[model samples]
Target: MSAPSESSSAPRAVNPVLAAVAWLWVLVPFGYGLYQLLIKIPALFGG
Candidate 1:
């Protein structure tokens, strides 16, 4: 059996713009969910 090659297994580099956009895509929803949880949860519970 042959051993795996490192050169063939390396991942392709991500584009910076796409990476930034993807990070924002994740962060925006996360931040919004946190905002709603902080502001809405207590109201829903009548606290």
Candidate 2:
């Protein structure tokens, strides 16, 4: 019935170690994808 509180919806503060881990979590997958696209795709296509 009542609207949700905005404060309760605010983003939580990230711990430094957790933040670094999260950044690597994103970068590792992205780097692997890029490596597959740039290197593996070219090898498959005889480039």
Candidate 3:
């Protein structure tokens, strides 16, 4: 384990599928909330 740092200084690549899933996990609820807020904006001001 200690010898790993001595091998190279290259950055690790992220898994594309994992990155997509992670982004979806964060964006889904955020998108839903934004959609709901937009739907409610007209009623909030008596449109």
Candidate 4:
């Protein structure tokens, strides 16, 4: 026999505040990187 694992537990509801924080954590860096890429793109094309 095997011991029960975390994935064997029932699903839980996500906390909205935590979800928002997680999104911000991911998006802030992504937005900054995208902004940097956009600024460089024009230079790449010699615009």
Query: Which model scores highest in lDDT?
Result: 4
TM-score of each candidate? 0.49, 0.49, 0.62, 0.61
lDDT of each: 0.87, 0.85, 0.88, 0.91
Worst 10-residue lDDT window, candidate 4 = 1-10
Q: Return the lDDT, model 1, position 15.
A: 80
For residues 1-47, write the lDDT of model 3, one tens digit per residue: 46767448667777799999999999999999999889989987898
Model 1 per-residue lDDT tens digits across residues 1-47: 67887667669886899999999999999999999789877777788
**After aligning candidate 3 to the native by TM-score, how far in Å is the CA of 8 from where it should be?**
10
Better of 1 and 4 by lDDT: 4
Ranking by lDDT: 4, 3, 1, 2
Q: State the lDDT of candidate 4 residue by residue for 1-47, as single tens digits.
A: 77888688789987899999999999999999999889888877788
Per-residue lDDT of model 2, residues 1-47, tens digit only: 67787677769776899989999999999999998788767667787
Kindly report which residue stretches of model 4 are placed more than 4 angstroms away from their true locations once superposed.
1-12
lDDT of 2: 0.85
Query: Top TM-score: which candidate number?
Result: 3
**Which ranges in model 2 have alpha carbons more than 4 Å from their true place?**
1-14, 40-47
RMSD in Å for candidate 3, one decimal?
4.0
